[model samples]
Target: MREWMFKSRQKLLTAALLLVSAAFAAAQDGAAGIEEANTKVRSYFEPGTNLMYAIGAVLGLVGAVKVFQKWNGGDSDTGKVAAAWFGSCIFLVVVATVLQSFFGV
Candidate 1:
């Protein structure tokens, strides 16, 4: 019985070690893929377009946040502002989506 318990523990330890090693390997591969993608993005080299898209994304996020905040807090003035912001964000997102679809970005 003791020997059986020891064998079972050893098997569990081996399985745990294998899982850890596999996870480490996967993490390394993911890191490498990210680095490769970063290099590719950098190499593509469209600074102006990238900046514009980034700004648009930021604006959209900010607008969404403002909208939610106003909606939750029940501020009338901010409600209008929130609606405007949310609308703009949605519009921007739609435009971005269309552009991405058309341009294959």
Candidate 2:
């Protein structure tokens, strides 16, 4: 009876080990899939970079016009408005660059 119990425990241990190894193999496959997804995401960064720059340029043009209008109108807050617009344009440009770098694109 003791021998039988020992054999049963050994079988259970072997089965658990097999299940653990299978899980590990599955995890490796999942990791590979994740790598593929990462690559796909990185691929989008190129177009996004261009789009960001374009948006910044447009914002800069619009901001310039608005600031010019304010200055022409003799508004006291022209400087503040110009500063805010310039800051936004700069932020857009910097964000694009940072995102590209962060994604290793």
Model 2, TM vs. native: 0.74
lDDT agreement with native, every candidate = 0.77, 0.95
| Candidate 2 backbone clash number | 0
Stretches off by above 4 angstroms in model 2 are 1-11, 101-104
In the range 1-105, model 1's lDDT, one tens digit per residue, is 999999999999999999999999999999999999988875564554455577777887888787788778887788679668667766765676676566554
Question: Best-fitting candidate, measured by lDDT?
Answer: 2
**What is the Cα root-mean-square deviation between model 2 and the actual structure?**
2.6
Worst 10 residues of 2 by lDDT: 96-105
Please give, for residues 8-44, the per-residue lDDT of candidate 2 as tens digits.
Answer: 9999999999999999999999999999998988888
Clashes of each: 0, 0
lDDT of 2: 0.95
